[model samples]
Target chain A: MSRTKLDLWVGFFVVIGMGALLFLALKVGNLGGSNFTDTYVVMARFDNIGGLKVRAPVKSAGVVVGRVTNIGFDTSGYRAEVTFALDTRYQFPRDTIATILTSGLLGEQYLGLDPGGEAEMLKGGEVVQITQSAVVLEKLIGQFMFDKAAEAPAN
Target chain B: MNGLLNVVRLLGAMVTEAIWRTGFGARFFILLLRHSGQSLTRVHLTIRELYFSGVLSLLIIVVSGLFVGMVLAMQGYETLQRYGSGDALGVLVALSLTRELGPVVAGLLFASRAGLAVTAEIGLMKTTEQLDAMDMMAVNPIARVVAPRFWGGVISMPLLAALFSAMGVFGGWLIGVVLIGVDEGAFWSQMQAAVDFRFDIMNGVVKSVVFGAAVSLIAVFEGYDCTPTAEGLSRAITRTVVTSALAILALDFVLTSLMFRGQS
Candidate 1:
């Protein structure tokens, strides 16, 4: 084969290979949508964070506004301390409630923010006082069974 | 009692031979690295080998990847639909291809095709006394012949693996969304949301690079160290494929453990 021809083929191979990598990064993976312009960290404490993992979406009104960055156990409060980075464009008042909610019957858990009527806007490093824990199915079922037994005796 | 003693002697000799060959392979690798400057200086040589090794193997890599991805979608959906999360077929296919199958399968194929060719080519050159002629003329055959092929295999491997993964994801999309009536929005969104670029994709690239280095080194060393006979050349080629395959799988396990341990 001619030198130029071989070079052309090799060049084509390299280009296609690189194109495949680019496609995997942008299309197959989440490289495009993950870029946030500016962000601030907000901490919320939950009594329980069942199956809540790091990098889960933090959504408000069913739209993702941030990502859960860190999850740790607060040693003093005996609660799950969840930290998330919210886009600067979206802000909530000091009374916003952070609730742990599941997507579907069996889907990933996310943090949902419901803003309350408050004049003060929350800033970075401030902890949201009102938070809801992830509801455990076993606990809910146990409570339901206990209530049923108690009512049966009364009946 | 005599038979048992002979068996013990044979076992000891095999162990010693294995250790000696391993040491020789390591030294050959170091020597190849030292002489590798010429392979880069004359870029055309490496590019030529790249054309032979990488471009030639593209067809098998792409077709196999597509079939693998389609099969993964079929199998993944059979189980996922039972749980009513059939939309997750995209995630399952993408994760498996990018994490495990992409590098492993591509590496194995590259070993069988390009690795065997490299071993045979150099073995033939040796059997023909061409290497001896080069040495008599004060020319280093390792630099002129071996290093380019070595670098070519090393460079082509990761690129081929990446292409395989991309083709696989395309295949999964074709089956899941185009053919089987999966939700288009949910399929892509779930895949993108689940497959992290840094954690999954880069780790795969790392795995391919390691596999490439191992397979390339094994191929070149076997070629360089073969006994320079027809039978010796046949054994060298056989050893190249078998060793490369085993090395790829074993190194993959080790790399996966180190890279993804406790990640879940």
Candidate 2:
């Protein structure tokens, strides 16, 4: 192979390979693509968090505004507390409704925020008072079965 | 009765011979590793071998990648349609290609295309006395002949795999979005939301790298160990293909399990 030709092809090869890998990582995987590095952390409490994982997307208006940073048990309240860092660009009112939601019917759980009409704004470390817990599919099915059994005995 | 007894003895001898061959191959592989340092200084030779093994294999890799991706999209649509999630074709195709098929299929293709050629070229040189001539000239053939090709294969494998994956994803998009009636936004957005860079993409790169090392090791060792004869050279080339393919697949399985063990 000619020296220049070899160098040219090798350079092309390296560039394309790296480009594909970067596209797969940043575009397909959405890794390091999140622009929420500089953000504020807020916590919320739920009776059941279900399968809401750390790093799960926190969406507002169906657009990801932040990510779940941590999850812990609140021993005093006997509830699950979730902390998320919301990008400062997307300001939220103090009366925002934060609810746990699953993307698809059987997909990952994320925190969904619905802005409420409030003149005041939420600050960092502030707890969201209005929270909806995750829907426990298994528990719902068990309760449904118990209700059916109870009705059958009464009948 | 005598023939039956002879057959039993032959079987036992064959097993022992296979064990001996494995040991010899292992030693040869270790020697290649030792001589690999010489490859760093022989930049010209390494580049030449890379042209042969890497540049020459691009056409086949790209073509196969595109076709594989197209097929995946078509099949994925059929299956996903039942769930009324046909729009998620991009996610299905991307996940399958990047995580598993991309590295595995590309490694197999690389072995068939480049690994076999390395084996045959080396085996021919040995049979034709070029290697022995180098030895007489006070040159170490392993450093000059084997190490460059080994390095070339190792470097080329991952790049080829990445190219394959890219082409495959494009092919799938052509079919799923352009040809079929799937929602273009859902296909891409869902894929981005689901796959993880560290988990899926990095694991695939790791698999391809390990496969590259294993296949190149098998190829060089097979070529070096062959008897200096026409039949021996042909046998070495065939062995190179079969062994490298088997090694790639087995390594893919072991690596995949380890990478995804704790994942739900």
In order, the Cα lDDT scores of the candidates are 0.92, 0.88
Model 1, residue B128: C-alpha shift (Å): 2.5
- Evaluated against the true structure, the overall lDDT of model 1 is 0.92
Provide candidate 1's TM-score on chain A.
0.90
Which regions of candidate 1 are displaced past 4 Å? A1-3, A35-47, A68-98, A113-131
Find the 10 residues in a row with the least total lDDT in model 2 chain A. A28-37
- lDDT accuracy of residue A22 in candidate 2: 78
Candidate No. with top DockQ:
1
DockQ of each: 0.64, 0.43
For B1-264, candidate 2 gives per-residue lDDT tens digits of 999999999999999999999998788878888988878886888877788788888899999999999999999999999988898898899999998999999999999999999998899899999999998999899999999999998888888888888889889999999999688899888888677776688888888888888888888888888889999988999999999998888888899888776443
B125: Cα error in model 2, Å: 1.0
TM-score of each: 0.87, 0.81
User: Chain A TM-score of model 2 versus the true structure?
Assistant: 0.81
Instruction: Find the 10 residues in a row with the least total lDDT in model 2 chain B.
Output: B255-264
Provide the clashing-pair count of each candidate structure.
0, 0
Specify the CAPRI tier of model 2.
acceptable
